[model samples]
Target: MRQLILLCSLPLLVGCATTKTGLAPEDVSAASAKGDDVIWTDAASVEAQCNAALEAGRAVRDTIVRESASDQDVIRGFDNLSLAIDETYGWTQLMFSVHPDKVIREAAQGCEKSLSKFLNDVSLDRALYEAAGGVDGEQLEGLAKRVHEHQMRDFRRSGVSKNEETRARLAELHAEMVELGQSFQKNVLADVRSVKITDAGRLNGLPQDFIDAHAPDDDGTITLTTNYPDFFPIQTYAQDSALRKDLYEQFMQRAYPANGEVLLSLLKKRHEYATLLGYPSWAAYVTEDKMIGSAEATDAFIGQIASIARPRMEADLKLLLKRKQQDDPKADAIQVWDRFYYVGKVREADFGFDSRTVRPYFPYEQVRTGILDLYGELFGLRFVQDKDADVWHESVEAFDVYTGEQHVARFFLDMHPREGKYQHAAMFPIQTGLEDGRMPIAALVCNFPDPSKGDGKALMEHKQVVTYFHEFGHLIHHLLATRGDYVKLAGINVEWDFVEAPSQILEEWAWDTDVLQRFAKHVDTGEPIPAEMVKKMRDAEEFGLGANVMRQVFYTAYSFYLHHRDPTSLVLDDYTDEIFRDFSPYPRFDGSYVYANFGHLIGYSAIYYTYQWSLAISKDLFTRFQSAGLLDPVVAKHYRESILEPGGTRDAADLVRTFLERESNLDAYKKWLTE
Candidate 1:
């Protein structure tokens, strides 16, 4: 699974030290303590909460504006206001994705629109900007100074100093962008496409457990959905090319026709917003604060990565194309539908491995427990299940994190797919940790195989196991990075491009033999995965490294190019084809509308290159463990303190340097690409 850090652009508001409303400190603490326990019962409840939060936020704004310049009370007032919005709008934004009920999710969307409008207004408030600017950076040190600088920077970026008319229009643009993003995501979530198989023999080469779980319906046809469990198995194992092509088309065209206009309008608005802020394009404006720093630099970095991987990609394509020719003597090129199947065949033929051979040892339940135990041992933390906790779905499980009897954080696992649920794996922040004893809350919404079906084993693929480790890395980042004084500086609030590194680094554990032996046991045989099989798994994993990197480059280019220029005359389909032809190793499958269902096009926008960018840093960071050992507690503790605990208090580059004792470089990434 691609790890998504869902940090909606809402400003991080930390806890306030004092409130001018004359409310007691305990009352302010109580207000900030809302977390996973707050449930939205209906649409009306969402609206009611939005209205209340806006009213209270306005009052806090007034109090901050009244404070004297250079007074510490101004900072407290801003923090109080931050807490108010986070407790209300932040929680609602998360509910919009994972809430089980349709009415509640829709209500949450409505609430998000209202909250976006309020945040836009707050961002443009010249009074608040002036008040924050009055703070003396010379009097502050560390996190406080960093937070003040960020507040000023965001204020300027928001166009708080623009003419009144331009500011009003900017507010309108922000609101529209929020609504369009919600529509784009909802269309993808609500639109779950499927393919029906009439002949059972079409399922040749699939694991028996998968076949058993997907038994035929009353009409003797097996149905497959675009969800990962069904879609991936068929693409990798099904012998019927027509079936694979049909499913691949459906999967790619997820929210088509509906989201077609929605995406274009979003791009147009984003471009206009950037232009209004005196930038040439959205890509230029968005990258200004990231590690890459500029659109030219982003282009250069992508070119560097593509050049490094192209040779390997060409070689990998030759091997896959050769495999395809065995089945079709006249075949000249690999189709998008043929890539997974042919890759699997090549792995088995060359590396003496098949992904299916390891499924029996990785039942869903054991993998979950094994990962929990692994993290607990490495981080000196404990996870205790909260069986009676309130959850949006009965299948959802909640756990509390403790460090030797001190409850430090809470997390929820909604690890299976259903109607109206988020269709991808991501970590949603429910509550931001505060310096004054408030624990953070986060949830992992994923669509893996559910054990409720068939023989109840719910065996997992090696890839899915790696995904689990990746997402848990995000959860652990949010839980451990709680020492910052401001919410914006705390948790996984690092630079947008750097957010995926910690999680990507954790994926290394999934490939380790020692880690797998602890939890990956045959469901029936009661035996651990053999060490030799793991060796084959590791070797087979490298078979498609070049093609995989190129595919990511294709996505990064698609996202960047769509926003780097004017979109009024751009045709979405033509643009997608152009990007694919330039960067992808495989030919584009006709009729596929990849952009319509690309959720990152809304959240990450032009910054989709962050994945590859962060992967480079992750590869460099993992060298610490490669030398010390995968499970070295001393290194883990040092990393937790240096990289995770500081959160966004310091620059991300500084954090990397602190951990590695040198500037981050592409040497590790280049080595991994060709090795």
Candidate 2:
């Protein structure tokens, strides 16, 4: 709930914006939205449709297997069936709107049921598995092996190995887990919609747009939500310590609604689900498909970093505390809210750098081109802007990315903030490739401030630039993936720990002055970024690096612990406190339910540690570029061919080794923590 959706007014394109749903402003204006159940009768009717779709798909697969059809025919069959399933899942995702529609629920449940039945059908499974894995090494080729492995792993994970009764229970558990996850998300969203701020003076040092957006009608005071743009900046810069404390408590207290009972129940249910699957804990059950594969390794990695970070973070906290005493006489020990504020101040003081001044050189359009230029030099890819695109939002701009004469992939840049949309920057894969002519389309979504205001220059902060590059890295990964004939195996479908490495690696380019000067130009003035300022930014990069790395390690370690620990012996609150207690700069409060606010743990389950694990790989990968030139095409092509193009076809560990000429080690990450 600390990251509530940030609503910003996006600049308009030439025409009216329309989403794939065709539910534009005009459509909504004329019709009252239908209820969940209004679209479909009950779960039974939805179930019938799902069954029919599955039956049709199965018949197609049977034909392919029986006839020993070529890969082309198999691809065509998959395309048609995948289209239908995609349509079904699209509606399934839309069910969690403000108004509940039972049709969405019914359809989702029905589809899950159908999928379960399909996976458990032994004859068909053996046929598909054999076909995908291949006989005499003549079956699925290239990325197909990756897709086959992913499918096989999923089948095993879903209790396909269990008896009939256990299989049935597995489906039930899946349905219940889905329901619980949805409920948990909705409850947190609902509980922390907006916090009331009665005093207007508390808004001192905040941006004007933030105040304008959050100010209540007929009141002088401004309110705030959990959105990163509003929350993080305020938490870091707000002068009023009381307001900061209030916001911090409100954010932290989001998880333990009803005194942690809800989260505890959910955790227990998760434990039951894992135990039912013949696993020791939820962590073990989920990790088999992930790169880390075990809690012991993940915890050990965290511990190694912690040993280095503990002293550094403590020293940094002491410095901040000493500063706080001079800045505000009444200040106690530095709290959660004060962390960002002091860090921001220390950064400016240490490096003589100001984010606002650096912003002038990084206009939104310039930053976009800068990212494209860096990749272009490295990968020999050209991004030509596509004027005629069926874009979902007006702020979205499309580009057709090409490698030499080959049309490799397309990209959409939705790089502005808007209401009712996801707040943080993320990459959404529109169309993933298989063996067929199905190419990939990826969108880079961000919440950067609109450029059309008084400034007319949409300058971006340094941190914002890093986020922009990070999300685009995901876009490149999705678009460049030449995976086999399965939708699930394409692009970001690699092991969760490995997926972030590609994105994290790109962040290093943002820090490099050579790359920044190429595209970082003043919007109105059109002047290049000064060398001295660039030097300062680089010098400041290592500031608070220890605390930052520790924060990531803490979150990652805590997530793995939550999944692996015994629920009976360690309650949800206790488990959270125990894992994260030593890592945080501030003291933990009783009944802290930070897990409730963590959407990653919900979406990724035990795989949240993958970020840190991937960071290790990314660090190792970045070091190669540091040794070689950052934009060296020879190295870039190696990355493209070995990592990006293969997608999840081969094992992620193999991909890392092939690219680096050795196994990925944690030494770079450990060294980074000490810095």
Which candidate leads the pack in lDDT? 1
Q: How many residue pairs clash in each candidate?
A: 0, 7
What are the per-residue Cα lDDT tens digits for candidate 2 across 441-546? 6566677877756565777888888877777777788778856655445556576667778888888888787788888877667878888888887766666666
**TM-score versus the correct structure, for each prediction:** 0.86, 0.80
Which residue segments of model 1 deviate by more than 4 Å? Answer: 1-36, 39-52, 67-70, 98-110, 176-234, 238-265, 386-396, 416-420, 448-456, 567-578, 589-599
Error of 1 at 569 (Å): 5.7
Model 2: residues with Cα > 4 Å off, grouped in runs: 1-58, 61-150, 193-202, 207-230, 328-332, 390-395, 418-420, 434-438, 450-456, 483-488, 590-592
Clashing residue pairs in candidate 2, if any? 2-226, 36-101, 36-102, 36-103, 37-102, 236-341, 435-485
Per-model lDDT: 0.81, 0.64
Worst 10 residues of 1 by lDDT: 13-22
Q: Which ten residues in a row have the lowest lDDT in candidate 2?
A: 11-20
lDDT for each residue of candidate 1 in 27-126, tens digit (9 for 90 to 100): 3446456354677778888888777777777777787788553446666666556665665665676688878888989888887767666666677789
lDDT of 2: 0.64
